[model samples]
Target chain A: MTRTLLGVVIAAFVVLRVWIWRRRRATGHERVRARWGPFAGDVGLVAGREMRERFRGKVFRVGTLLILAVVAAAIVIPTLNSGKAQPQQVGVVGALSAPLRAIVVASATSAGATVHFVPEPDRAAADRDLRSGRLDLAIVDGRELIVDKPPGPTGTSATAQFVRAVSNDLGVAEAVQAAHLSAAQASALAAARALPLQSLQAATTKGAVHTTSLIGLVLVFVMLSQYNTWILIGVMEEKSSRVIEVLLAAVRPIRLLTGKVVGIGLVAFAQATLIVAFSVALAQGVGSDLLHGTAPVLLASTFAWLVLGYAFYCWVYAAAGSLVERQDQVQSLAFPLSLPIVFGYIMALTAAGSGSASELFKVLAYLPPTAPFAMPVLVGFGTVTWWEFLASAAISIVCTVGMARLATGIYRRAILRTGRRVHLREVFSRAAG
Target chain B: MASLLELVGLRRRFGAITALDDLSFSVPGGQVVGFLGPNGAGKTTTMRAVFGLTDLNAGKVSWNGAAVGPAERRRFGYMPEERGLYPGMLVGEQLEYLGRLHRMSGTDAQIASKMWLERLGVGDRARSKVEALSHGNQQRVQLAAALVHGPELLVLDEPLAGLDPAGIDTIGGVLVEQARSGCCVLFSSHQLDQVEDLCESVTIIDHGRLVVSGRVDDLATTGPRRLVVRVEGDRDASWAGGIAGLMISEVNGGEARLVLDGDVDSDLVLRVAMGAGRVTKFVFERRRLSEVFREALG
Candidate 1:
């Protein structure tokens, strides 16, 4: 399953590249027309500078390596610990009936375990073997089950489950043998089936899907926080360094701001793609069940939300960055801006982990700010339809356009106002007046 | 015809304070004009308005005879009062980037960037990060960024504020050459003497209002003439006091500097000086630019 996912990701990248190339070719005439147009080559130049700076920065390189290392460990460690379960050793004292032995073996199979039996000379020997941990469980004279520790009430552990299964199956077989008047009756009792179950509502997502959703939510949260902060700091750096004044002289504030956000967004997208691709490939290579049986739609939803979430939050961060001229000011502003993101991430996490999307969670899926995290989980749970996802996306895109305009306005008004922090109220009031 | 840049009725307000009030001036092509003012005299604001960096309350910036727009502004280069450049970027790359932003093609930008860096005497440091250069070197790079695109109107704010004498001479020479090449160069500086040396004309503003502007020689000569006399071993200015409409502005050892009205006879003042003692020196001269600047502001 992971291998297929890896292949799909690689193919998607190739398809995206080809589509971009074709789109460029299609837009060639338009680009030519725009070459002599106003603000031509502005955004590309800005984005290129940003990409170069980020790629050159040591922090980006080191941070990506660290995250990859952690991701690899998360994938590999589980597989190593849970590789192949050790066989359960069971001791039997006195004469063991053939039917009883068969029942014990069958019980172990039902518990997803294997058993090896050892004959004990007496009860004391069986007790000694159980005490010494040589035997996981023992049967005393075909009557009682003995173990080093008492089994859990629900038999949650592997050993406890195996012991419980063995005891119950053996007891049932003995009772059947005693009650049976004919062979057909005993066989019929042994083959009894459970009644069919039904539910009125739709079934929730399976455990694998739930796990995938949780991972997607985490990726969204981490990526949003990381990239939004980059935009914030990048703006602050330009402002504090006073390089913005030079840039604004050559380019319009709107064009400059647009270029900056687009540049940083590109870097963020590229970094995210690399991380996702690395994770899928690592999981596939390591034979880990992480992301196993993950639905393609769920992966797409996660990536889509990532883009949408970035689109929604980047402008806010960029605008906030323009208001301040100091690193300390950036810190003070960043926390308040991140409040909504943190809230949405936590709420989405709860819904994904619990495998249940509440009404509020569903409502959050429609809001642009929270939709990036919420809508994808709804997709994972199969609670949100395709149209619903599109509606939420459309809403987010609309909100993002509005946000970009507002942010551009604020950035334009405040970026050149150096020395002191510019207030949002000041910008808005001036615009209104 | 060489292009002319004009700022007409430019007005701007920062809350209650007016930064530029009906400020109007013209920078003719093939000339270097000094934008002179004290601190907070709207020089920077006016320059920013030229590039549309500052929102004007009212103004029209025109080139030649048409109102300047993005296309015209693209042909203009500016060095802000507060020097700004990406500290982490290579000097040559930074210049190239600015050149490209100003509409130069990639190859043209590269060539111009190299030429400007070499001309600014920072050619060896082109590959170095801007932050690694000395302050003067960085300032040169900043100037190079503005000039790299061969702008028709080069506006610099305090371009010579912190330069050493050699740096000043280099930049001053560049400005003169740019003007000779038919570019209109407008720059603001607090160095009055340097302004006098470099600018062909000047526009002086105070409290966001234009005080005086004209050809440097015209403005200086239009001010009241001074009559300077040196006596043989006499330190008193009583010789010049006998002449009507003559006021002694200064009296040093054996020398008296007098301000004369238009009707005052400079020949008679010299005669009076000769009668008082053996005259060593006599001359009539217009006020210096510094004197003109101070008297205009006062």
Candidate 2:
């Protein structure tokens, strides 16, 4: 199943990449026109500069490597531990019956476990072996099962449930033999019919989905904060250094801001793609059940959210950056701006950990700031329909458009006002006045 | 022909402070105009307004008889008062990027950037980071960036500030060459001598208003002409004070400078000095731009 999903993802990526390449070639003349066009050329220039600087910077290289290392560790550790899992060991004493032994072995096999049964001289010897931890459970005189400790009443453990099934099968076989029925009757009595069961609600793959949700939330949180800060610091540096004056001379404020965000957005996207590809490939190679069934879907959702989250927050950060002329001011502003992100992250993380979506989380999924963190988790939990996902994404995009417009205004007004920090209220008032 | 650039009734206010008050000026093609003002006199504000960098409360900046817009502004180059360049970027690459922003093709931008750097005497330092360059070299790179796109109009603010004499001459020569190539050049400076040497015309502002503006020779000629007389003898030329309507502004040793009234003749002042002593020199001179600026401002 994982292999098929992996194949599909790889094929899709290749096809999209080729399609872009072919389109670029087919529209070569249009591309040239775009390069020389008034707005596009200016935007392209700024974006090109940003992309070049970021790709060549030490921070980007080191940060990506660090994240990849973390992802690899997260996948490899669980797989290695699962590979080293030990099977259950049982001990039997005093003429263990053939049917009983057969039932015990069959139950263990059905439970996805192996059992190694050893013969003991007496019940005392079986008890000693079990207590010494050489055996997981002991059967004395082929009648009673004993263990060092009692299994929980819920019987959720595979070993406990397997023992119960073995005991029930033995009881049925003993009753059939005691009835002294004919071969056909004995056989019919021993064969218990399976019970028919029905459930009104469909069962959810809770464990895998919950894990995917948590991973998605973290990725969105980290990518948004990191990249948004990059935009903030990047703009602040440009402004304080007064390089923005030079750039604004050549291009419009809106185009410059757009190019900056687009450039850094592409960098963020590239790093995210690399990390996701690494994770999926690593998970598949290690046969890790961590991202088993929903790996491809979860990854794609997380990436989409990353883009949305960045699009929503980058403008705010960029505008805030223009308001301040110093790095210290950025530090103070970053916390307040990150409040919604932090709030949404914690809530989404809590829901993901508990394997359930809260009502508040469902509401937050529609808000642009929190939706990047919440909607993906809701999707993971199967609580949100595809239409709901689309609605949330559409809402985020619309909000982002509004934010970009507002941010552009603030940035244009405040970027050149250098001296003390420019207040947001002042920017608005200045615009109005 | 229409003025290459014209600011008609430009007005801007920052809060209660009026940065520019009905400031109007024009620069013709192929001419270098000096934008001179005292500190806080709105010279920078006027230049920024020309490039549409500042919001004007009223008025318009017209380029070649049309309202200037981004497209026209893109064809224009500006070096702001507070000079800035990305310190982390390579000098050549930064200029090329800026050229591209001005709508130059990639290859064209690259070639132009390289050529400008070479012309500015920083061609060998193209690969060096901006921060790695000396202050003078960085200023050169800044100029190169402004000119890399071959803009039709160049507006520079304090382009000669903080430069050594040699650096000043180099940049001054570059601006002259730009003007000679038919690019309209307007720059502001506190250094009147440099302005006198480079600018064909000047616009002087004070208190956010134009105090004086005209061709350099025209402005000087419009001011009072002085008759300077230097006698061969060591005797003082106090006799110049006796001449009617010829106010002797200065008389020291054998030399005297007299400001003639409208009805007075400069030759009369010289003849009077020649009679007072054996006159070795006699000249009629227009007031220096610096003197004219001080007189206008005062």
Candidate 3:
């Protein structure tokens, strides 16, 4: 995962820079407006700076890519070795001829079991796997079966059912032999009975893993939150240091703050893109079958949501950062701001795990801070229509604009009024006043 | 022609602390005005109030006959005591960016930044990160950033702070050059001698109230007229009791300190001192601004 993040860092610098150059050259006011966007160039610059700085950070960049790599491994490893671990993998002891072995497979099926003659190599691995809770049960001598001792009620009953079936089979066969049944009759009975118990159940397919882009989205949101917070803190640091007073004389606060946020956001986008591209290329190159079925939507949503989520959260953090002039105050303040993010993330995770969006999760999708994470999860779940995605995007964009206004107001109101952590009350009231 | 910047009845409150209480002052163009005070004297607070960084509880700041809003303030430049420049950004980029913020376009910003960097003798360090610059050089970068837009008014709070003699000369020369170019420069400094050299006018505030303000020489000289006389020939002569127009106050080291009548000239006092003894030096004491400040606050 950490290795995968390397690509994002490289891609962010190259691709985002290209994007910026393209933005600069874009034509008319309307044309420029369309391509460069109203705030994207500025926002991109900030995000880009942040992405570069953070992706270069040993902890965040590496941790996220590591997580993605782990996810890829989970999706791939199981599917690649598909046909090996099933209940049909039967364990047997004692010397039996090849034809008798076929008969035992028939008999086990007759008793409602499909047997795979693992022949020792698998039995050794199965023994280890059983201890690790992998296999359902191990059959020895086609009679003495070993099952994992599951806690509480379920384990004993299942064991009893297996034992009773094997014993009943032996007893019925013995009774039939005493009544003078021929070998041909027993063979006919076993084969006909084996027909009644076919056991090949398909597990959850990898196709479903592609649909789980929420994890990817959460990654983007978390990164956006962290990067945006960095921007906020950066602004506050300047203001508290009394630098803003001088800066105000040179440029408007709105422009300065906007430029910073855009710069950092662009950097972040680059880092994320590089990591995504790196992982994809690496996965493809390695023939890592785990990534073979991983959906592009998951990666795409992650990148898109990262940019969108940052647009929404950066202003809030920057605004929040402006409220306090001192570094010590940042930690206490960062917590309250992060609460919505945490709540949104938790709700999104719950929805992802259920493979469905609940009504409550839908509410989270509309919230600006949460939407970047939650809405993407909804899209991944096939739970949202295109209109709904568009609606969420629009709402998020609106929320971002509103947040920028609110934050800028809060920042401008409180940044110069330093000395202690100015109460949230003071910030609110001053803004209102 | 009248003044570049004016603050009328500026008042600010931080909870119970009235940082500035109805403060008012003006700085005309083509001169440097000294903003003087000790710690807690609202020097910085007043500077902030003028820039419109702090909300005016009840007051106004006007620049060139128009109210100083955020846009209006963009035409002015300030160097706050906080000493801030983006640490991670390149020196050239930061300067150009600030210039742009002041409404300078790309060509103008680039030109100003390049010229200023060259003037500072730091043109080679343009691509260097601000963090990599020396403390004095960083301060130079900050000054450059402030002036890159050629603002009409420059408010520099503690402009001479944290500098060695060489740094001071460079800044002082720059400030004088700007003032000579008809820019109004209002700066606060603890170095009274520096202020004496640089500022034509001085405003001294204490405890959120204006104590004294006027042309520096006028304010210092406009108080009571007092003279110091050194007499070589006589120590016991009645230098104190009998000289007309000489309100002598203290006598020591064969010299008499006296206050002169308003219409009195130096010759009258010189004649009296001469009658007492052969007068070598007769100097009038212009009460140092520092002494005036002490008298106001202490």
Candidate 4:
């Protein structure tokens, strides 16, 4: 009886707590409305609606998942391949000396490979194994190295590197042995180091640095393309659906448009943050060298440029979106809008791969349309000064403001005038007059 | 003082077309006014101008003798000519969102949304997406969206255009109830009979100019009275020509419909009709609202 009474009390308490919690949750928007005031309240309502719709939308969920899957594949595939190493087959013909065998094993290790010596009954057997692809390399007695193909001057294949290492080390060891050097003299020759390379200018864009910049460029291009197009379609949908008339009656056109872009921009930022976080965590967890030695500044610059790029292009797409009357028109309009982005992306990619920023690339860095791609490459290359970077950002920001104002004006005028496509030239002339 | 929504000399031009030309009207609190006009008569333009959706080339919109701005507009609920709601959004949620946009508190908005939906006969369809509802139900939701915040001034353009009779009655009742609750209601519609039944007063515009503005009864009664008489013998138009203020507007067989201008004596007209022929049927009636609309536009 006492336990039953206790259970009843607990159940009642639980219900009461739930009711209170729900009551608070119900009033949360009221709190936000009070805090945000009237102007922000209107904008916030619009933005909140947009955010909820987009987040619940199937396209966003599926698209985000697809992107993450692709990113995971790109990171994991190479790591999976690198984790397993195949042993190099070395055919031993005739008599093998311990010293020569030790030399061959050391050369294999230096070439980042493992060697397994396979005893050959005769040179003919060794030649057969080589022809059958069973043996990567063959040693004839202890005097010569044999192979199906000779390593080229700049060949970087695993077998080519192994053969070259073996030949070079074997030649040096044989020469040292023939000189009959004492232990100390042989040790001194083994300990000799190559001269350190020095240059008047720093070589910053090399190896992984270049790879990082290329990845950053791809990210910026992708995010700019994806999110800006979202703003475009979103605006177009509101206009085409005739919802803009009802919305414009409640709030100013500028606020509604601002809310839309801001909402979509938040979604973009969230998706981007998730991808970036996932990539970093996955890369680190797998001990992959993909993001190894990536500079924090490079990551920060990439994200900064991403924001700048979005800010500059979102307004343009929004303006274009208001002008178009149909979904089919979106494609024709979007294709021309994407040309500058594609151009900058291609050029930045080329510069990143070559590890050199050309004069044209430098010029493009100053231009807002291409700067998002080119500026990051320059930053990764350590060629652009801080002031120059800030200057480019400033230019982009100023241009964005002007573009936003113009786009807002166009949206206000064209949003309500339906039935036909609005011409940009007409909007511009109207504004001018 | 009763709050009044006043549109004074509103003029707007769309390129070469003048959509609203010196259009002026006033809707006082606690009254439902009908905005009647033909196509391109600037009715929609005038309503759009009130909400600041269209740029006015001249004049201003004032509320209670004060200039109306965004703050004032927020208090005004508007249903555009083209009915629109986010088709994917739930009807209830859309209303709540609109309520919040109009500056209603969250809790207030929720309660009001539920109340309006129930009142609109779509209470059960609150969870349903707008696209899933029938056209009549969607129209109810559109009206609910406009009224969710309990706006002080309600402006609806063609709120009755697409509704069935039952829908028309329900919506018409709700609008009347809103006005009785001291909310100013101004709606545009082409249904003259419904306007006559529902509206307290009407403003009729033609070619962007105000053609008639007065109470429905006054507008209907202040016009020429129609006197119809059917006699045994043929009644020619010559009998009505003898009366100074009476003219035969229509003649069919033995019947003649005369228009009595000003204060023409009905007894003298009855006597004249008796003299022409043995009176069979005789009745004097006020002009219908449709006749007033036609004559006003003309």
- Isolated chain A TM-score, each model: 0.83, 0.75, 0.64, 0.80
Highest lDDT against the true fold, candidate: 1
| True C-alpha contacts between chains kept, each model in order | 0.46, 0.49, 0.43, 0.46
**Model 4: which residue pairs collide?**
none
Report the interface RMSD that candidate 4 achieves against the true structure, in angstroms. Answer: 4.9
B239-275: candidate 4 lDDT, tens digit per residue: 6679988888778886788888778998998898778
Proportion of true inter-chain contacts also present in candidate 3: 0.43
Candidate 1 ranges beyond 4 A from true positions: A1-40, A77-85, A89-101, A116-203, A286-294, A431-433, B228-257, B264-281
lDDT by residue (B1-298, candidate 2, tens digit) is 5248988998888888888899888899888999998999999888888777788999899999999988998898889888788889878778877888888877787788878888888888877899999989988888888899999999999999899998898999999998888999999999998999999999999989999989998887885777778877745567776878877667777677767788887777767776777888788888788887888899
- lDDT for model 2, please: 0.82
DockQ of 4: 0.41
lDDT of 4 by residue, A1-433 (tens): 3244345546654864775475447522223223122335766777777776886789888988988897788767766655647888999999979978998998888888899999999999999999999999899878888898878868877778889999998899889999999989988997778999998866646755665676678778888999899888888888886777788778888888888888888778777766766666666677666565544467678889999999999999998899876899898899999999999999999888878878999999998999999998888887889999999999999999999998998887777777878887777664321
DockQ, each predicted model: 0.43, 0.36, 0.36, 0.41
What lDDT tens digits, residue by residue, belong to model 3 across residues A334-399? 888888888888887777766667677898887777887787777665567878877888988888
Q: Which one is best on TM-score? A: 1
Structure candidate 1, residue pairs in collision: none
Clashing pairs in 2: none
**Candidate 1 overall lDDT versus native:** 0.84
Better of 1 and 2 by DockQ: 1
lDDT of 1 at B151: 91
lDDT of 2 by residue, A1-433 (tens): 5465567658766975875476447421112222222335666667767876887789988988888787788778766654644667888887787777877777777665677888888888888888898988888777787888777657656667666666666677677777888998876765757798786854444665666666667778888889999999999989888888778877889999999999899889877876776777777788877675665576677789889889999999999999998979999999999999999999988877776676778999999999988888877766777898999999999999999999999999889888889987888875322
Please, what is the TM-score per model? 0.87, 0.81, 0.72, 0.85
